[model samples]
Target: MTDEGDLIAGRYRLQTRVGQGGMGIVWRATDEQLGRVVAVKQMLLHPGSDEAVTEQAVQRATREARVAARLKHPHAITVYDVVRHGGKPCLVMEFLSSRSLAAVLAEQGWLPASNVALIARQISGALAAAHEHGIVHRDVKPGNILISRDNTAKIVDFGISRATGEATVTDAGAIVGTPAFLAPEVARGGDANFASDVFSLGATLFAALEGHSPFGEVDAAIVLLARVARGQIAPPKTTGPVTDVVLAMLRNDPAARPSMRQVHEACTAIVEGRTPELPALGRPTLVLPARRPRKRVVVAGSAGVCLLATGVVIGMSLAADPTTIPEVVSPPTSATAATTVASHGCTASYRVTDAWPGGYQAEVTVAGERGRRLVGWSVTWRLPEGHTIDDLWNGVLTRTGRHVKVSGADWNAVVPAAESVAFGFVGGVADGQPVEPKLTCRTP
Candidate 1:
């Protein structure tokens, strides 16, 4: 059996195990001949595997090397060599000091909108390149996305991917791909196509923003697959600016989905600070149930804070005097201001903190009217055309079409008269100056 420190193929020495999955174990190894570091993925052949299973595993390893080797893109992992070591197949590839998107999400919860946009742009470029080569990355999930310390994202693990005209490798009636990220057509036993990859990419972005899969977590594979087939995706509560594109990629009908080229363009637009021009998403055939109201959990403390549906807490500083809160002047009265107003003893002000070619960051501060004590507060605003919020912090954010809402987190739920709470977000704004969003506030 191969162990740490073992030499494989006489030219590579395993230093340590870097990753493991159902199909293989990845090790950080040294290419002795070249004196360079490399990653080696050793195929797994279970002791009790039948001849057919063993053969299939070998073919899969060989296929993975072939598929990945044919494509050359900055965001696609590179394959160096395929070798036979210790009677099993192994693939030598570039070693990256990076963590998978799944690992990052586990550590940081959800990513900011601008960050997700940058990642989506890179992956889309990779997918577009792959599609041009007649390759379909059948499995595109967070676990397969590697992010460097500098935040560059690379797509990896082509273990299940296949060329467009390739003969089927899977057994009859057997499905491939992660259930949580599978496209509806694939879940229903249809062949995986470029569109299917697009759908999967969308689901990956959904997980990056929502901190969970769109299908939610489930213990049973069959149950999860059924949910995917039914297309019962709960609306994402936190994808600020990328919401439209994410939803468009998730269209139940593959025909309605954007092509990888379109996806790349849209994502690039988001990264450049411009709003993406996406195709209209007509009503999908699979009707989703109305969203259930989010439940609140109140944690008692010196300052009563209520955890809202988004798992964000709205906090109040007990030591600060409510009367000391500063009042922000409302934007000059105009047609946009007609729809924006301070109400229910609260007012909100929006300011753009940073801006770039295709992306920008903004912050909102919500102040309570003098002497008004609000148990909870929610701020709503209308985004200008072509704009979308990608990610936010300090509040629970959700969007319904162009209307955006931010609710206080549980820790900041109590707004003692005249006191204020704030949240910030990054998003995309199409041409011209970033439009100032019209704002309104309410208490519940």
Candidate 2:
């Protein structure tokens, strides 16, 4: 039995066990030589297990660790070193101060689709990089995704990942990975590949948004695997803006699915509130955004920056005088807005919806004149120095230093005459009053 503070390979000193699964036990340990903390995974072998099977597992882990080490991406966990201790392989990995997405879902049940999109965008970036290097992460379930306190997402545990062209490491016809998240072909005992990873990614996202596996949950592993093998994905009832891309990824045919790179791009678009194009669909189909739940608004005052939701007043600070509007740079109004704006351009309004220590929430609504129809719109503004956006939805957010741009998504792109489209964002500031930026809106 491994005890706390036990030294592994005469270098890594174990502190406490952090995780355990069928594959291995992960310990938080310190590398005395490097004076740093790392996660050390001790591959598990059942007591009295056959020696040959044990050796094969050790060899496989060694090879896979080498494969994981070759991958270098900000969104992927860093593999530091692999060592042998007690005749079993121990994987030294970066110790992140984060919790697994699986644990988050287990506690929260489900997340808003916009939040899920942000997570999907990050994980897809890491997985895309892996695919580009010909590495297939045979397992891509929620348990492998770590979300830091700052909300940065990184994919961990590439233990089952294999580089393309690597010889089979597991016993012949032996299936690996969690059953609920497996691609149909893999569930049917086919080889896992990049497309397989994409499907698994879809299943993981499905579980996140829908609160259950795409095949639904079953008590029997054999029954669940059968459902996955048959590609029996239940319809998504709550994914909203992410439904199209998620469904495209979960397509029944492996070849029909978009590449991991494409998935990343699509998720990125979703994070920015733009419609995703699925050329992989191979046919023309109108992709519509799913209905989103409305957020409540609290009106504080009649002046300064006021946030709105669902066309109702939201966060507004009550001024000493109800009629006194604060002096700030507001978006171009309908009158002077004509010359400085486009011929069929739009106008945008900004308001502070909510605020707290070090952070605030805001909303922006873009509208066209009563008789003028605005097609697609993009709003550009600038943030104060040291202020940054944390999260945004219903529009794409692009930031270059203090400059920012928010573009309308497909569903919100075409605003009928007299109607308006809006997007909201949460921002972080360093000890200063939030100021509404002068916004320039244009239509194309």
Q: After superposition, how far is residue 138 of candidate 1 from its true place, in Å?
A: 0.8
Q: Per-residue CA lDDT of candidate 2, range 1-444, in tens? A: 788989999999999877654346778899999999988888766445587977887887778679988999999988888888878888888888776676566545577888889999999999999999989988787767777888898888676677888875752556666667878777666678999999988888877787666776443344455566667777667746587788888887888899999999989998987887667574212222432332121111011010011111112222223123322333223211212232346787777655566776677777785547677789897888778875564464555667898876433556666656566666778986566677788787
Best by lDDT: 1
Please report, in order, the local distance difference test score of every candidate based on alpha carbons. Answer: 0.70, 0.69
Question: How badly does each model clash, as a count of residue pairs?
Answer: 26, 3
Q: If scored against the real structure, what TM-score would every candidate get?
A: 0.64, 0.63
Q: Which stretches of candidate 2 lie over 4 Å from their true place?
A: 280-444
Report the lDDT tens digits of candidate 1 across residue range 65-183. 88889999999888888888867889898887887776566446578888999999999999999999999988787767888888888888776787878865653555666667888
Best by TM-score: 1
Q: After superposition, which runs of candidate 1 have C-alpha atoms over 4 Å from their true positions?
A: 50-52, 283-444
